[model samples]
Target: MKLHTIVGVALAVLVATAGVAAATPGANAQDSNSDDAAKQGPPSELPDPVPEFVSSIHDAVSDFLDGALDGSLGDAVNDVTGSSQSPPTSADR
Candidate 1:
């Protein structure tokens, strides 16, 4: 057999063995006490994992995109109707 063919077969066998091992129960079993860790949630004094600023920024971006899309649609309609009016600006709101 060619060298590449032999190497390919070896790699395939190794992958198959690994897959079988991973699928087998009791292989690298977790500790029986692992459930104890979940009993306690995040530390008491710590702030929320997600900060308010992150959410505010996300809301701002979402609002901006929504406004842009609305303007684009309005512009499309105006173009189709041969109206020369400009799209409404944020100040118009």
Candidate 2:
């Protein structure tokens, strides 16, 4: 039961994290497309003028998010699930 639960939860996290990560670049592209369209022509139906900077920026952002997910963010999530410490009290302690 515990094994199944862990696997299930892990799968869920993997799926959700992937979904969230997927959105960042896609949303940016959509915005860029829209802006370009407004300034130029049809964005949703027609093709976009490919900017060289866009590819590099998208790659960099994807890399950063990937690193964050694999590094501190992963630690943060694990800490929440694995910690025994009491929830923080007032800072006056």
Best by the TM-score measure: 1
Q: Each prediction's TM-score against the native? A: 0.37, 0.29
> What C-alpha lDDT values do all the predictions have?
0.69, 0.62
Off by over 4 Å in 1: 27-47, 55-93
Q: Using alpha carbons, what is the TM-score of model 1?
A: 0.37
Write the residue-wise lDDT of candidate 2 on 1-93 in tens digits: 699999999999999999989776653465645666578655567677887655654554575577743434334433545655554446936
Best by lDDT: 1
Worst 10 residues of 2 by lDDT: 69-78
Q: In model 1, which range of ten residues has the least summed lDDT?
A: 68-77
lDDT of 1 by residue, 1-93 (tens): 999999999999999999998889875566657986566678779775985555554554565577743445555555555669987889999
Q: What TM-score does structure 2 among the candidates reach?
A: 0.29
